[model samples]
Target: MTKGLKPTRLIADSSPVMKVPTAPAHLSRDAKTEWRRVAPILVERCILTIGDLGILESYCSAIGLVREASKHLQTEGLVLENGKRNPAAGIMTTAQTVALRAASELGLTPVARSRSGMSAQADPDDDTDNPLAVR
Candidate 1:
């Protein structure tokens, strides 16, 4: 037999329906709230699958960290003794960056596609269940 490239086989309906997993028990209350807020949107848009729960938890936890860091920075001003920047300023910056990166990765940012080059295919006007669907 001659060596040649094999033809690719396409499976029908290979994309699995998205399912939202329960918030992980280890997540803090704020993290759980963030998960509840974001998970459903990702699931409805079919961006996240049930198997991606771990990554989802990590993203939500990062958001919680950013929130906590922001609170600390707000309560305790941006500078400490000797006019040095508060350590919490650095922590807030790092946490905010981490959270933003995670959100962009998950397509939660408004301009995420411009940065990540991943486009969401779902059309807002394509809902079949709505009797008053806009054309």
Candidate 2:
């Protein structure tokens, strides 16, 4: 699907009969945690597969880097000697941008919601009384 296009149809009722991919062993603790948290949701939604593991790992790593950099920024402040902004702030910003970009590509960001034409109040059960419901 195109990056900014809304899907006009719902997913098939049949789930993909594929095994779930395991998280890479090289990921950091926090990255692994993130992988464990999001991988199943993507699999169940049929939006991801074993081939996409590398990209997902990269996204999770970027998230971990952002979190670590933010902690350093909180402790060390944003400026350094000679009134220069701390380099860690730049690292944090760059990491956050990369993470957001990865998430957007994976359709996990707020922009994806807009692109998919999703609304907070949308109801899946509203089809019950409609004649067009496929059963």
Candidate 3:
């Protein structure tokens, strides 16, 4: 038995499916939990459920949160027809536009990749005002 070494009997060398660690959790504990807590709220504000709102983008390869939102809007009949007047189209607010733009920029079309790479989740446990914290 060595001071810093695991006992040989306790070590089982085996290869399992890779596990991804969370982003470097250097943030203060309070801030870290607060960020995790706020993420769902932000997604709701963006008119998406937390699971569909890019939170699971890291795990899923299907259409991301933005595309889903667009689909939701379309299903709700908020789409403006070509050369047609729709009084309800005006109800599509500016926030929805921004979300759609972001989704488009992220390549949210059906052909989009479900998994791009292992990018770190934007941990907002530090400064909430940071642009990088934008979902």
lDDT of 2 by residue, 23-126 (tens): 78888777888878877866665656555667788888988888787888888888866789989888878878888887875667766755532332345556
Worst 10 residues of 1 by lDDT: 6-15
lDDT score, candidate 2: 0.69
Q: How high is the CA lDDT of each candidate model?
A: 0.69, 0.69, 0.37
Per-residue lDDT for 1-135 in model 3, tens only?
657842212111243113332322544343344334444443332323323334333312122333444455667555345645443443334434553454443334333323332112333344544457766
Please name the candidate that would achieve the greatest TM-score relative to the true structure: 2
Clashing pairs in 2: none
Off by over 4 Å in 1: 1-17, 113-135
Screening candidate 1 with a backbone cut-off below 3 angstroms (N, C-alpha, C), the clashing residue pairs are: none
- 10-70, model 1: which lDDT tens digit per residue? 1222343366668888888888999999998877766565445666777898888778877
Model 3 ranges off by over 4 Å: 1-38, 41-84, 91-96, 103-115, 121-135
Of 2 and 3, the candidate ranking higher by TM-score = 2
